[model samples]
Target: MLRRFPTPLLVALCALTLTLVGTAPVSAAPTSAAPSNQARQLNQTILYYDSSRAAEYSSAVSSAVDVWNASVGNVRLEPAASGQHAEIRIITDDGWPRAHLGPVRPGGQVTVWMGRQGTAEGYDAVRIAAHELGHSLGLPDTKSGPCSSLMSGSTGGVNCTNAAPNASERSRVEANYGRGPAGESAADGRLLVDRR
Candidate 1:
């Protein structure tokens, strides 16, 4: 019962990565409703599936979020109903279509569509879940290296522990929120994806 994360990003620095590939134009984080310093980790909420592909594997997703919650002094989360409260949905397909993948709301909602469960096309549910939540929290893909970061453009496998957000990535999320706990730091992170 583990939420399988997406493909293991061929990370170099992070020891892991999560990437989603497509020819879509790179997106820029919207400059709205953030403090000037970009050092906030607002105590917001998140939503995701807790059953089937998603439910069967939440550990991975939880690991990634735990890192953000602890590192920054702004962002926080609470679980919502599987199909409600949050905006999580799955693509079933290997990768999220360009149209389906987009920016997430700050301190708003999160969704993961379980389009496909297993197979290469079927993105690791946990990894996708973790990466998508990062977006909702305000993190954006830098395409830093060809691989090695969860925020990469390609939906590569994510190294939950290694996928730890970098300074800029952390700032982006905190900027969206206010700040996380005072002295929180990243905890154990991991996810295992698979279909029933």
Candidate 2:
């Protein structure tokens, strides 16, 4: 029971339908598919460190910060602005290098003791600082790991002066900070005294 329209009329109707479809507004896709610009900005985790109390080890601490900043993308380490609170504090002492274990949040505090004992024993100062900082960033000692492992700490020996973290160590750090500020948890708080 189909009625045939004139060829010219049918062609015009088809063209009008195409135009209407082409001009129709599209519904927005789910935002979960891509994060908004502001959301991405909020997800960036930057931890400031205060090393003013580190005394003679300040240079080593700076070098350690540089190593970590270069190694990870999810987190960044920056020197605290004057008068600003810092999450990581570096100090020096005569004991073996150690740190308070933490996945320290922006306002949380953790200590990195740049012990002269390790340096006095001939361990590299920069390596010691970086290793202690690693503890603050939630890493534990892999005492049996080789010199290539930055978390290996003093067990790598005084001859193991590698200041940069190895691939595994870097990946661990990235994972730790990838969750951003909201994901931060209570600091481990246990003091890791690296006497060995």
**Candidate 1's residue-wise lDDT over 1-196, tens digit each?**
9865555532442452223334434564455445544533334434342333444445655665576666566546555564554443433345342212323333233344433333245444444555555655545444533334556534344322244666766775666543344223222122222222
Worst 10 residues of 1 by lDDT: 187-196
TM accuracy, model 2: 0.77
Instruction: Give the TM-score comparing model 1 with the true structure, all chains together.
Output: 0.47
In model 2, state the lDDT of residue 54: 98
lDDT of 1 at 69: 63
Summarize candidate 2's per-residue lDDT along 26-83 as a digit string, tens digits: 6555554567656755776889999989999999999999999888777789899889
Q: State every prediction's TM-score relative to the real structure.
A: 0.47, 0.77
What 10-residue stretch in candidate 2 is worst by lDDT?
25-34
Q: What is the alpha-carbon lDDT of model 2 when measured against the actual structure? A: 0.87
Report the CA-based lDDT of candidate 1 relative to the real structure. Answer: 0.45
Candidate 1 off by > 4 Å: 1-53, 81-84, 87-110, 114-127, 144-148, 153-161, 179-196
